[model samples]
Target: MPSHAPDRFDEVPGDLSRVGAHRAPRPRHHRVRAFAWAAL
Candidate 1:
């Protein structure tokens, strides 16, 4: 799962675009979630 985090960080921007205009919230949420996990 640790390996997956950086992968997701790399993907998030591309995903934000593909996910459309509503992408803002989701990315922010995931970023926060990712940071929280990383902090642990």
Candidate 2:
């Protein structure tokens, strides 16, 4: 057998949604709390 170079991940598009199933949107409780604290 001979050595072979693996395919590069950079060939994929920067936008993952275009190539794979995208995650569902969800509430960001942490960001809300951070903003609330910053406001104080």
Candidate 3:
């Protein structure tokens, strides 16, 4: 059971770092594009 604990703990931070690094730029671009289209 102790071996399982470290594996489970590693998953949460791993997912967060990936999302922060890779996903952070995309939604921001989409948001700006939507605003631009709405203004037009």
TM per prediction: 0.32, 0.31, 0.31
What residue pairs clash in candidate 1, if any at all? none
- How do the residues 1-40 of candidate 1 rate in per-residue lDDT, one tens digit apiece? 3554365444556534456346555445788899899999
Q: How close is candidate 1 to the true structure, as a TM-score?
A: 0.32
Report the lDDT tens digits of candidate 3 across residue range 1-40: 3554466435444344355336443555788899899999
Clashing residue pairs in candidate 2 are none
Highest-scoring model, TM-score: 1
The TM-score of candidate 2 is 0.31
Question: What is the alpha-carbon lDDT of model 2 when measured against the actual structure?
Answer: 0.63
Clashes of 2: 0
Query: lDDT of candidate 3 vs native?
Result: 0.58
- Misplaced by over 4 Å in model 2 are 1-28
Candidate rank order under TM-score: 1, 3, 2
Per residue, candidate 2 scores C-alpha lDDT tens digits across 1-40 of: 9977768643666554544443333457968998999999
Local distance difference test, each candidate: 0.61, 0.63, 0.58
